[model samples]
Target: MTLPLPRQRRTLGRTGLQVSPIGLGCSGFWGHRRFAEGAAGRVLATALEQGVNLLDTGHNYSGFNAEPRLGRLLAPLLATCPREQLVISSKGGTLTGQAGLGGTEQRDFSPAAITASCEASLRNLRLEYLDIYQLHGIGEHQITDELLGTLQRLRERGLFRHLGINTHSRGTLDWLAANPTVFDVVLLDYNLLQQDRAAHVAQLHEAGMGVLAGTVLAQGHLLPYRPRLPALSDAWYLARAWLKPSSRRLMRSASKMRRAVASIASQAPAQTAFAYVLQHPGIAAGIVGTTRTESLLQILATDPCLLDAADRARLVAVFGDGRGSPSV
Candidate 1:
């Protein structure tokens, strides 16, 4: 049931950079049932042909395989497309290593580690500069002065065009406010299922920072409720299954509420979920990731004309002021 890739573009926050509304997530290339290397390259090619200009990867993804693979695939294409036209982004703040029978692991962040991470990413990406270099996860303990200093130095050295933090916590936003002008973008997990930080998102946007929404599908719990087989072992899937009966009941109730809302919204359940975020004034781009190229295309193809008042009301009713458990 894969849909055709849609053609859509939006301005990436204050950078004035325009890219496809739907960006490709490279993390999918890692972990279980990894996509074949050749198939991965083809996915990028297909995405490019379909007008997806923004590609995201991280140093820790796929035990450091994602960036190099993406570099190999996009290097040749760079000559064909203007460098400024593509929004290539990668993140730091985490270290990855091979752990046993094809397993992977990661380490936390530090100032020295940030520099080293960017250097390694630069080499793996085969690029002199990155359009966006993000700090992967900035929990309270990780956001230190040294870490901020390191990122500033990287920008001073022209290693990256823009710098930002990728986090879902309010603490990260607080850190950004403390260190003004240190970041140009912020990638956070925000969706209808989790809206606890919607006000924070608005605050960041008001502060002249770009907002990139990730995990818009609430880790695939929204719409159609297709459960992958047990062997998949995806964290979100497992978490949903393990939730207490009360939580599960709430989740099921929320899902049913969302379905009803979608029915009245005249959009597919998935599209409705995405549109919920798209309608947010603060969001500059939505980062949707899929290993399946067809799924990626489907995300891009859906036309999110503005969500109407009834749609907004329905969302509020189901998700309740867009906050708490149902807002992921």
Candidate 2:
């Protein structure tokens, strides 16, 4: 049986679309080998039945297999729940043709490529129009007039309801902050371990743009259980101290911060991370890429309003004490 929808809904910027605080990142559907056939569909179904409204996917995920997999499952789900009840989002502009190790090929953000990417994504997703279409990992150098014009044309054609950019580059954030009138949403990486872009979330909100946070758990770094050790702890810690002092400090601080957050809320480390990102008033939603239905349920069960003022202050002291984050 399908579950009831959650109570909390935030407006996706000025689009007037009320989205759940937690969005399902569908990349794991076909992007990873560990996810077996029908597993992703099951998770997707659970997420929907439990009231997740936003589903985010990329065009080039799993060599373009992600959208097709999601489409196959979405077809039946849409029959039960109307398409308008869900916010379907997809991204483009990542060249999958030359996507191997140690290659000279880079992402193509040109107008022709962007248009073709969107058209192909629509076909793969088996959808009439995407709720939100984003430029995948767009950087400052890629924000050209041609690219903007192409996106505008796509919107004019009813290909997508809104346009957004998924980026963590400082230059791209600066450019977006300067030219805020172009897009409706911005997806970026913001977690307790990396708060550099935290300030930008407010900036985008002030400019009337939705801010969707990615890497909320630092890509699983904040997961509670991990391998204990294999005698490399001393060497690894020593190397970190010498090569990445800031990262070392952040790691040490994270351990203590997790305990503190758990003391306040009694949640897993990963859930605490989600609460941190979702607590930000400017944040519209926190995108979580889970491979299991249980994982999605854990996220769905989290209270977005868990973090109090003291919790926020302690978290800020951990990663915001004038220390630079290590490059990912």
Best by TM-score: 2
Q: Scored by Cα lDDT, where does model 2 land?
A: 0.77
Candidate 2 clashing pairs? none
TM-score of 2: 0.85
| TM-scores, all models, native as reference | 0.82, 0.85
lDDT for model 1, please. Answer: 0.70
Report lDDT per candidate: 0.70, 0.77
Window of ten residues with lowest summed lDDT in model 2: 97-106
